[model samples]
Target chain A: MWKWLHPYAKGEATYRLLGAWLPWLAGSALVTLTVGLVWGMLFAPSDYQQGDSYRIIFIHVPSAMFSMGAYTAMAITALIALVWQIRTAEWAIAAIAPVGAVLTFIALFTGAVWGKPMWGTWWEWDARLTSQLILLFLYIGVLALYYAFTDARTGAKAASVLALVGVVNVPIIHFSVYWWNSLHQGATITKFEKPSMAPEMLIPLLISILGFALLTGALVCQRLRNEILKQEIHRPWVHAQLGVAEQER
Target chain B: MAFDSWYDFIDMGGYGFYVWLAYGVTLLALTILVMHGLRTRKQLQQQAVQQQQRQQRLARRKQQERGTA
Candidate 1:
């Protein structure tokens, strides 16, 4: 039943798989982001009321979406490491933390920037914003725990525990706007009602989201590959693989 | 060509700052991330090579000691 999973549980196999994925992910990210940015920034029509201010949504929305997604991914990896005691899973959890942290920062920063003009203040202790602030702290906590210990394995375990615990807050962050009538508007993209956006605006926004997702995937794969190589340096398979590349060096 | 002039593009109907700032920051962050990943991979590869060399040296020394004994 778990036969397919067994092969990839090993660091070497995981490293190779991620290696193959990195170029594809990176290439797709480059192309999509180029198209999305150009289309959204220039081609898309200005908003009716907010005019160009609403254009910020292309970046703000996607970063905010991925910030939550990356954390959820980290938590799942943490759970896998804990339950299955897979070293590769532990590495994955650690590899994702910094990337997730940066994405969360981007979300919060862009959110604040967008808020200034819309809300007439740089920031407010609104439910949605506050919950996102907590999310940033959670990302920091995981990274801090990772570096707190001397033993790599012990640090990974500790960080995984923190990541799993931090994941409990994700839902709270996501629902804060819905749970309360906060200043922050309810989700535009996810609402079941017909989208308020015109087709021109909607198309570019969707493209931006897809582009950001691809970039995130590429970054994660590359980082995970690095983590695997670092952790498995002492293993025979790693040395054998390096031997094959010795000529290139 | 999208707008009549630089000023018109910059005005963006008065939403220019918000729109451009968001896109600018997004581009900067993603570029930094990609560069960091590539740099980290190179550093890790270097460290792996060093570790392999150290292991090989230790193994050779042990073999020499055994031969002498």
Candidate 2:
């Protein structure tokens, strides 16, 4: 496994790996998001309680879901970089942070939009809402810290430690509704039990979730590939492939 | 299917503001992420190519100078 993983840990190999997977991720994301969101808003039956407003669930839930997911992913990458001492992993931390920050922003934006009618307010200080807001700050902090230092290595080290520490908030965000009597609703789909929603409503949401996941994968892969190119531009392999640097003399 | 007509669909059963707002914000954010990533990647790729060219130019200059010497 070490031998298998070591090669891919190199910038070029990882770039190729990401390139190979990019198409599948993009294709699946395109198909799923189109089908899921369209059908969700148009064809899926309206909810008994929230009516058409509940259709927002298609975006809100998925964005919120991925916000936490991206954080966890970043934390894992930080762990990999720290433990394995991999430059690619550190680059991945930089690549992942921006996307994660954007996803967190999406989650917060959609959540606020969803809240206005349901909770009768655009903003709330409830546990679930508050913790999720904090998650956004943590993401911003990661990005900010990443660019704070003159040396990227130093910046990444600081960001990695922050990401590792911020992971504790992920669970708090997840279980906050359960932990407190919050205005936000409790979990719709938990692992241990059946989903609370009907098939028509649940199916579209599940599809949207998959779509969002695929989109995230595609974006991350593309970002990683770009980071590899930028970081490894001076490497012999990169120069050899370009064939422009060595010939210009 | 959920609405009686196009207007009703747009109205989103009177929650149009909230529903559309949520979807709109989500889509806008997605678009921003995509555009930003693409633009940054392109710029980085361009920078990489330019740097490579500069390196090659310097290398050739040195080799030519050495050959002449």
Candidate 3:
């Protein structure tokens, strides 16, 4: 039943797998982001009311969405690492947290900027804004817990627990707009109902989201690889691997 | 292409500051992240080299002490 999981249990195997993925993800992210930004900025039809100001949605929505998604991913990885004692998963969780936190901050900052001209205020304690703010706090909490302990393994465990506890807020953040009468408008590109956007506008948005997701994956893999190398520095295989990398370079 | 002049592009129909700032900041952040990653990887490589040299020195010192004994 768990046969497939056995291969990745080894740090070397995990490192190799991530190394294979990083380049592909990085390439795809670059291509997709370029296409998305150029298309959205130049070709997409302007919003009837907001005009070109609405173009910020391309980056704003994707970053916001991925911020949430990355947190959820981190939480799940934390749970796996804790329950299964999987070191690779532990490294992955740590590697992902900072990136997720940055994305969350980006989302919040961009949201505030987008809100000012449209909503007549930079920010409000509305459902979406408030929940996003809470998300930022959760990210900070995980990061703070990560460094609070001296022992690496103990720190990872404590942070994992914190991440799991924070998982409860994910759904609340996702549903905040629906749960409250907020000044922030509800989901536009994310809804299951008919998309309220034209193809010209929607295409760039979808592309940007995909690009952001890929970029996140690339960053996570790079960070995870670094973590694995750091932890395995004393292992003979690590030195040999470094030697090979040096020769290749 | 849509804009008639530089001012029109900058105007963004009066939402210029918000729109451009959002894009500008996002790009700036991404650039910083990439540069940071590269710098960190270089730092890690240097640290690894220093650690290897320290280990080699320790081994040589142990050999010298054994010879004197």
lDDT of 3 by residue, A20-48 (tens): 99999999999999999888877787888
Give the alpha carbon lDDT tens digit for every residue of A1-249 in model 1. Answer: 589789899888888899889889989988998898788878887777776788788888888899999999999999998888999888888788778878888888888888888889878998899989898899889888888889987888899999999898899988999898799998887667888788888998899889889988988898898888878778878767656354322
Best model number under TM-score = 2
The lDDT of model 1 is: 0.83
Residue B66 of model 3 has an lDDT of 100
Interface RMSD of each: 2.2, 1.8, 1.9
| TM-scores for every predicted model | 0.92, 0.95, 0.93
2 versus 3: better TM-score goes to:
2
**Model 3 segments beyond 4 Å from truth?**
A244-249, B61-69
Q: What is the TM-score of chain A alone in each candidate?
A: 0.94, 0.95, 0.95
- Scored by CA lDDT, what does every candidate get? 0.83, 0.86, 0.85
Please give me the total number of clashing residue pairs in predicted model 3: 0
How much is A75 displaced in model 1, in angstroms?
Answer: 1.2
